[model samples]
Target: MIRILLADDQRLVRAGIRGILDDEDDLHVVAEAADGRAAVAACRELRPTWC
Candidate 1:
């Protein structure tokens, strides 16, 4: 599976994105953040493929 981390201020946006990614067979959402700071922290913790 491909790990993904999403950073967005809007919870709905994040949920939508997660739904789309979750529907994919090869992609998965590993983490989410509501701010840049939180995103950075998640990046460090998750170390997603993109990061």
Candidate 2:
């Protein structure tokens, strides 16, 4: 499985991306962030395969 961390200032953008990725059985969205700092924090905490 591929873990993912999605970070975007726009909620819609994140949602759209998550929606697309969600269709894949092997792709998983483990965390989300609204800004850069939150993104970093989520990255550290979740340790997703892809940022």
C-alpha lDDT values of all predictions:
0.90, 0.95
How many angstroms is residue 6 displaced in model 1 relative to the true structure, after the best TM-score fit? 0.7
Q: What is the lDDT of residue 39 in candidate 2?
A: 98
Which 10-residue span in candidate 2 carries the lowest summed lDDT?
42-51
lDDT at position 45, candidate 2: 86
User: After superposing candidate 1, which stretches have Cα over 4 Å from the reference?
Assistant: none
Q: For candidate 2, lDDT tens digit of each residue in 7-36?
A: 999999999999999999999999889999
Clash count for candidate 1 is 0
RMSD to native for every prediction?
A: 0.8, 0.5
